[model samples]
Target: MASSSMLLSLFFTILLFFFLSPTLCANSQGNALHAMRSRLSDPNNIMQSWDPTLVNPCTWFHVTCDSNNNVLRLDLGNSNISGSLGPELGDLKHLQYLELYGNNLRGKIPDELGNLESLIGMDLYNNEFKGKIPESFGKLKSIRFLRLNDNKLTGSIPRELANLSNLKVIDVSNNDLCGTIPVDGPFANFHMESFKNNRLNGPELKGLVPYDFGC
Candidate 1:
């Protein structure tokens, strides 16, 4: 009888662990977002809802979560918040839409952002961001809309970005990018306007012109 009681106890313990697993994951994601909140300068108190004392960040404003409480979206565009992005943002593994456009954020786009494989839309336009665009961004296989226009980013567009089959809209206009545009994959469908005002020489002419010509 004692053995049977012990087995039942073990079963209940396993069940309890499974039930709490989602909460634990939510708490971790919350912490990641809270770390980002702590770094930004929110003069309007827009991030006041980001209370680490809470059970999860799903209840916080501008944060959207999936059914399992995994953070999925962060829409903080044009909120007048100013500050550089933190590497901790890469911790949002399930993030899809990261919209921080039209802010005064300055600094290199974190290479860690490339770790978000589930990302769909990443808008960092109209900011003061500089430095080379992270080559790691080529890993964003799920990305659809990548708009980094009107920034001060330099360096050649990573040739690896041509490998993203899901890319539909891309606008790197008004940046300091160099080199010939990749003529393969999704890049084939993009127009010159999508790359306007940049230092790009033009599209790659295959064997006639080198891909990195004058870059």
Candidate 2:
């Protein structure tokens, strides 16, 4: 009986270790998160609450994690974060929601953001970002909401963006964007509000209907 119990104990120990290995690997991924943190110049120190010494990013305010302890959301809206997007953000392979609206973030959206295959929602509106939307954003197949409105971005809307098969909402209004607006796929159903106040010229766009954009 003693020998039999010993064998069972060993089996259970092995099972526990196997189940915990993935968690260990994810926890050690702190280096990647730290790299992302180091690149941005947080002028207001709002992110000072994100202490690496904490048990996990899950515990950090504004950070959310999934069942596997992988980062799922990072909402830093209205935080006044300034600077360019660092390539290290690509390391967050499981990120699903990223909200950085109402900030002073400048520069173009990073092409590396396409690496986040699991992303579903992205909001970077009301900022000072410039440059064209990266062609690589077409790869965000799982994205459902993408809002980049009320910015200073300039350039033609990329036809490649129509590749988001699951996109339901996309707001690119109040920018300096021009050229033919992509119509077809999910984009065909969106109202004029989605592309309002732009220099877009296309039969696909009917222009913004009369509506008071009251403050």
RMSD of each: 1.8, 6.9
Model 1, span 1-215: residue lDDT tens? 99999999999999999999989988998988888887789998888999998999999999999999999999999988988888888989999999999988998999999999999999999999999889899999999999999999898888889999999999999999998888889999998999999889899886674466556
Q: Backbone collision count in every prediction?
A: 0, 0
What's the true lDDT of residue 60 in model 2? 67
Cα lDDT tens digits, model 2, 1-215, are 99999999999999999998767656654556666667677887877777777656776677788877888888899987777676777778889998989988888888988888999999999998999888888889899999999998888777778778899999999998887677757888788889999887653444543222220
Cα deviation of 106 in candidate 2 (Å)?
A: 0.6
Off by over 4 Å in 2: 1-20, 204-215
TM-score of each: 0.93, 0.80
Cα lDDT for residue 112, model 1?
96
